[model samples]
Target: MTSAEAVPFRFFSLQVVRTRRLGPSLVRITFAGPELRDFRSDGLDQSLSLFLPHPGQDEPMVPIELGEDWWRGWMELPEDVRAVMRSYTLRELRRDADGATTEIDIDFVLHGVEPDAAVPAGPASRWAAQASAGDRVRLIGPSAADNRSIRFRPPEDTDLVLIWADETAVPAASAILESLPPGTRAVAWLEAHHAEEAQKLSVAADADLVWLVSDDGAPAAIDAVRAAQLPDAERPYVWIAGESGRMKELRRHFVNERGVDRRRVTFVGYWRQGLTEEQLREQGE
Candidate 1:
């Protein structure tokens, strides 16, 4: 929760307080710690680096004592002893009466956890699936309210908001929807595996939501978005997140096909197909 003057990010020692099943593929875990009182974030899509322990370990092993050198120190540790780090979006944060953050929620996608899964669940997914009260973990997150890690930034002149997200980015997309000012115009397309995954989203903005469920044999993302007529907007902001391949495809559709300005489009590759997070990092993707 504390950071050096030069660094806006720091390590937080947290323990799981509870978990709720959001859907067949999503779980929401709430974490809290005394240090969390220092957590500050104004961004709806705040990014966090979570460190998790291996099975049988009591807590994640991160070299936080090294301070600014923590990353290098952690990288030098034995692979089996070092923590498993994964990126996630902060779904929500609660504040005390004094405006100090008290607790935070992170929604996890429980991919490949079913018995009939094609790929096995990775360390982070496995950990989240089994997380419970008192399960210890570490996080490297912003200590400042406004930092670069928060990516959902729409220009002040934006008149329309366009969003598309896959299951991995649903938590962030949902948060953005909830944060929009009243009467703001927004359109969002969310992709899910089953109808049960289409949770009710609350928003003050005048939004049109399209849920594409694979189980229901919904049209492909490009085709659906291409066929629809968007509301008239002079300055539109596009935000997209999901698998790397699909994200790129959508970006092209908006910029090249729809004639949206590339500068107004914000796209993030939350994950990639057929690649583990570790592998993606190793390849410097």
Candidate 2:
């Protein structure tokens, strides 16, 4: 799923049609595009690359016809007009009665800002915080025929599910949880800054939710996962995400301490603790 050659890509020019606040730190951005009619997803933790314009730019200027080679083309553009690309999870995919898809939702975490206090500081977060209808952005994602890049691939024998995530990965985890089959058993340890960051979850699966409010002395995501106990199951699958350092610790605990098969675990380090996305990319993280 991490390899571009493994799953093909498609580009869409989406216009912001609506914006809403999902929580104190989350904002929902709804986008519409003609190409979206052919858009499809695996429904759990689907991610896409968004090319957002700068403050003064009305729409993001991007390269075209790159297809799988798009990254190279985008990287070659001048920084001033190239636009900033950020990866985001698909929160929800809506469809109409005739099975025609409507709009897609992406939840953005307003980082470095308080609940209804002030605008977020990050480029993506700030854009989302003040997003208005008619704003246009470029997205590189999966088309209806080539959405294989989605990373929620659990084995058929998966029985017990274990998950660990921070606020940055909550939207992806929420989509995964809500899409779980009825009667499935799963345990999740989610980290957040405050209680207001917790949103209602709609899961038919038998899920035990553990919310760890991150603060002065709160347990980290890895510590929480290490301290918890998973239910009995012949085959268990783990999906852990968020900061790279914490994920590395949790991966060791599951594969070494619990004797879980490394092949059965699907882990993603969305970002590093003390590095920006640009830094992560520059170092080939």
Clashes per prediction? 0, 0
Candidate 1, residue 55: Cα displacement in angstroms equals: 0.6
| lDDT of candidate 1 over 121-200, digit per residue (tens) | 88888999999999999998888899988889999999999999888898899999999989899999998887888989
Q: All candidates' TM-scores?
A: 0.94, 0.88
Candidate that would win on lDDT:
1
Candidate 2 lDDT over 145-259, as tens digits, reads 4365477777988898888888878888988888889989999887777677777798999999888876535686666777887798889999998888878888999999888
Task: Give the Cα error of residue 134 in candidate 1, in Å.
Answer: 0.4
Report RMSD for candidate 2: 3.7
Task: Give the 10-residue window scoring lowest on summed lDDT in candidate 2.
Answer: 1-10
Best by TM-score: 1
| Model 1 regions more than 4 Å off | 1-6, 282-285
